[model samples]
Target: MSARETFTDRWMTAMSHAHRLLLKASRGQLGATLGPMKVVELHTIGRRSGKMRSAMLSAPIVEDGRYILIASKGGDDRDPFWFSNLVANPDVELTVGGVTLLMRARVADAEEKAALWPRVTAAYGGYSRYQEKTARDIPVVICEPR
Candidate 1:
């Protein structure tokens, strides 16, 4: 679901509508978004177990063909389920549209965070609000194409 269309959202139809809209723009495929941010399927090894975990997320493109993703988990008090998995294993596969690629992942540092967060928040405004609800700083993971 998109940021505006959470599982707990009041308007279920709105969420469905959005998913449909995206699918159509994508021609029933992936990577069909407005701009800067693209939908990518990320596969990461589980932190506790070695099993693979997957999720589709929109990450903003930053410098050097890298992407910035937040572990907001829809503003939950805890980090996203995938966050620790990435920490334990930063190497990941990204399926963007029809292209499957490898991306080395690392949580952005203070300077990088300062530079990238605004770009991310601009693409998805909810991220700023997500930060406001949590005490811990939200992490921005950079996925560099490899």
Candidate 2:
């Protein structure tokens, strides 16, 4: 990995750990939400390693019992590793508001993304900025109860 990628990975790992710690320490009273978005702990089987991996991510949009995730990776050129993992294994576990649920994940198709993009950007303008920063198209991931 390049130095910047390494740093980004390390920073993301550290933030996930800290977010989990906050949720645990607060007994789900705190850290359950980020601004208007809810925090979800997503667990997916690692694509190559076959081990379970977890990431703390904010769901910018949730509608019709589905959680929408943006694989922006802070606008990195490459998609997030967790996105790859889920693509390899669609079955996933999601913890939201201290409750865990089994969910299936998929990348939204072009039409879906086109429709959801506006809502996502409205929810968090940072996402628009993230997209502008990268050449690769950011993916919109949908997670629904399995």
Candidate 3:
């Protein structure tokens, strides 16, 4: 792993551990927060273990009854593990602001991403930076009520 990737992996691992603890303590009421952005917990079935796994994520765009997730992996070249899990099994559960719902996830096509990218970057400028730092086309995932 490159220095950047190593750093990000460690940071994200620590954050995920803390976030998991906080979610348990608060009944999913509280966790990571930043600049008015919405934080959510995504529940997915592990592809290899067939067990449930949870990851804390930021939802920069939630509109028209859908939630948007950016699979930037902290600008790393590879997608996040949660992204792979969701792709392997689209059935998911999302908890936002202490409210949980059953949802299905789909990766946005190029056209859909083209439309949403501007708004996503507008919501949080870091996304643009993330894109610049990575060679992969960061995926945009839409999660709608199931």
Of 1 and 2, the candidate ahead on lDDT is: 2
Model 3 lDDT tens row, 30-122: 664556567888999999999998888988888888999999987888899899999999999998777789999999999999999999999
Using all chains and alpha carbons, the TM-scores for the candidates as numbered come to 0.76, 0.98, 0.87
Which one wins by lDDT: 2 or 3?
A: 2
> Which stretches of candidate 3 lie above 4 Å from their native place?
1-7, 22-33
- Residue-level lDDT tens digits of model 1 in 1-146: 66644553434335435654676587756444536667666789998889987666678664567767788776766666677888889998876665777888899899989988888888988889989987879999988887
How should the candidates be ordered by TM-score, best one leading? 2, 3, 1
RMSD of 1: 5.3
Candidate rank order under lDDT: 2, 3, 1
lDDT of 3 at 106: 100
Which model is ahead, 2 or 3, in terms of TM-score? 2
The numbered model that scores best in lDDT is 2
lDDT of each: 0.74, 0.95, 0.89
Worst lDDT run of 10 residues, candidate 2, spans 93-102
